[model samples]
Target: MEISVRTPAVEPRAMWSHSCTLDDLVTPYAVDPTVVARLEAGPGWARRWTAVWRASRARVVCPVPDLADFPTLASAPVRSFTWQARQRHRPGLQFVLATSRMHGFESLEERRLLLALDFTGGIEEVLSQPFKLRFTAIGGGEDHTPDFLVLLNGTAVLIDVRPGHRVKDKDLVKFAAAERAAASAGWRYLVVTGWRRHVAAGLDALSARRRPMADRLGLHDELLEMVAERPRRFGDLVEATSLPAVARAHAVHLL
Candidate 1:
């Protein structure tokens, strides 16, 4: 069965000529194959050589609650019209907008629809798609559904979302295995922990204090403080941190 899922739409307004530069237009998202396919399928579509200033812009139409509701935008205004006339009236073509003015995107395949959702709607579901890849530990195995897993810069990785926890060694092993697989597979992994400060203060007594620890770099003051006092348990982080939104990544490093 062929799946023709609508691609994530771009907010072209953020790419104004005077405001945007050559580099912004060259990134992976800007020239994504899936994105380009959708654009080329539009009327008057041209792959211009004049660069970004003259390249055709993608539509930025009225906002509805979701991609399924975007068709409601066609009846608005002509100036507001994106492919305003006929394409919107096509026999069978779907247009979806899963855009944000403040962030970047990292899709998995050249042409595909990925997991997307709004708050309170994201639930843990099995990898129903056969193409969805996951790592298996040498023997440890995966957990009560991972906290989160989705694509980024074309890689699939795990995310942690529990607010706080009394972590178990078994959970740690599963996470460690996931990390190792991600590295070998060239995917990114992340473990976002919260409440570092409180945990740190609590661990200070157990730590071998070095007057001023060098582990204070890059982390939030709270987390840095915790690490400064002593080593931390992975569970401490689970208790403190919240999982990142499906569309927004919390961590960037390889697992």
Candidate 2:
């Protein structure tokens, strides 16, 4: 049997230009120097803390979309990845956005990042390759397309994902243009490169805990209570439970 789902509708906005300074992109959130100083005392803390701070503070300059715009934005056409297979058949993955459409990702990296985004407790909605934002560049008018448009904490964020090695001078210019556009719209902008290993792994493990059997057997509540008392290994948690061997294995898998 075939199932059909309706794509949400979005209203089109007029294109406009906005300009921003380098400093505007430098710090998206206000920073406390004292906290930074304390964190800097630890080995490798400065670098790690700096990255976290930048990501957290990344400011949006775009206007928050009203509730009505969600359906339209969620229904936006995903960028085609058909050309990608011409070079090599890298397996693609699709995400079921909060809006309920299957949004495709061209690379495993993008998929992993999407998982991370979905696991982010604060994210309200996600729209992939949502819309084009036009901006003025050095010599002419240019159009910039961000990879994802995210709504969190009642604000909008424009995200572009690129690996560090592939970032070029021209790409920086494009990002600058995108940043300005985001600022004008009262939204924040982010250029995501790497994922935090622990965060990604934890979310992946947590996502696996959604099996119906876990709930039916009361293993879900038991496991949560055990973990809350103190961190426990998967094997230990399984052993602690009175489930049969096969059931124990399944429970561990869920954990």
> Clashing residue pairs, candidate 1?
106-153, 161-243, 163-239, 164-239, 165-239, 194-241, 200-226
Candidate 1 ranges with C-alpha deviation above 4 Å = 1-144, 195-255
Local accuracy of candidate 1 as per-residue lDDT tens digits, 89-167: 2122111123221111111210111122111122222111111122233342233223333333333444432222333
lDDT digits (tens) for residues 1-255 of candidate 2: 221222224322332112322112221222223322321233432122110001122422222222223343325433445554366434455654444456666566566667666434466767666655444444544555677777777677777776555555556656665555455456777876544324456556755653345346666566667768997766787778767465464654554
Worst 10 residues of 2 by lDDT: 46-55
TM-score of each prediction: 0.24, 0.59
lDDT winner among the candidates?
2
Task: Please give the lDDT score for candidate 1.
Answer: 0.28
Give the Å error, residue 35, model 1: 41
